[model samples]
Target: MKTLTALFTAAALALGANAAFAKDVQPDEVVKLVNAKTIKSLDELKAAAVAKHPGSTVTDSELEDEYGRYIYKVELRDTQNVEWDVALDAKTGEVLKDERDN
Candidate 1:
């Protein structure tokens, strides 16, 4: 009985953690936010990233809410094959973090 209770508690904790981490922004919601000026367009955000890392190719991107603030995370690869991770403030199109992905 004790083992079963421990298993259930562990499962509950795992599920709760998964739920907290998997809160993804849906496509339509993103569109609505852009329309309402709550966030910058993806194209503009990408442009800002490219401007900072000239000649780099965008590898991956995601829009997420971190610490209750919307942010756009972009990954890039440069001519020298260096990987970069860039985070931008989705609302104001401000670059928050730009660092190598080593």
Candidate 2:
């Protein structure tokens, strides 16, 4: 137990400011943006990506605030086992970039 605690302490120290917050987050930023109707929901963004490549499985996803613009980034694995990287405008649900990942 002590070893585990020490490891967690070391990891948290290494992360510095990136470590977990001291205060509890009230509302998720993404949820707040979607609720305010300023940006689309994650479901909408995921649907848009899947629409481009039917039968693909979303392997990973993330929402990023880039230059004040919200971007939904998705990684997909298609039926053919090809990996894809897809980026969308979170507000407009527009496909910003979609290409096979090497």
Candidate 3:
């Protein structure tokens, strides 16, 4: 029983270490999606993320395709100097997550 519990704990840690690394949509695909109006522009997505934490400045961002979902991930630093992680749906400009980074 202890061995099984250990395996579960280790697996969870491994998964958490690399939470989003499966499929990344290519740059060409990103342009196509934007032109086709299937997804919002990266600029738009970034703005949406920043709006989540007012007075926050974006530090880094990336577009990824997670199991067919176009996710826009943004890292930011707020006016108070707190780091944050934000995720948005590229298509609808929805804020999926807004968490403060440790």
lDDT of each: 0.89, 0.85, 0.90
TM-score of 1: 0.76
Candidate 3 residue lDDT tens string, 1-102: 999999999999999766755477788989999999999999999989988888999999888887678889899999999999999999999999999999
Q: List ranges where model 3 is wrong by over 4 Å.
A: 9-21
Candidate number achieving the greatest TM-score relative to the actual structure:
3
Span of ten consecutive residues with least summed lDDT in model 1 = 17-26
Model 1 Cα lDDT, one tens digit per residue, 3-101: 999999999999888658635578898999899999999999998998888999999998887656888889999999999999899889899999999
- Check candidate 3 and list the clashing pairs: none
RMSD of 3: 2.9
Worst 10 residues of 3 by lDDT: 16-25
Please give the lDDT score at residue 43 for candidate 2.
Answer: 91
The lDDT ranking, best first, is 3, 1, 2
lDDT of 3: 0.90
TM-score of 3: 0.81
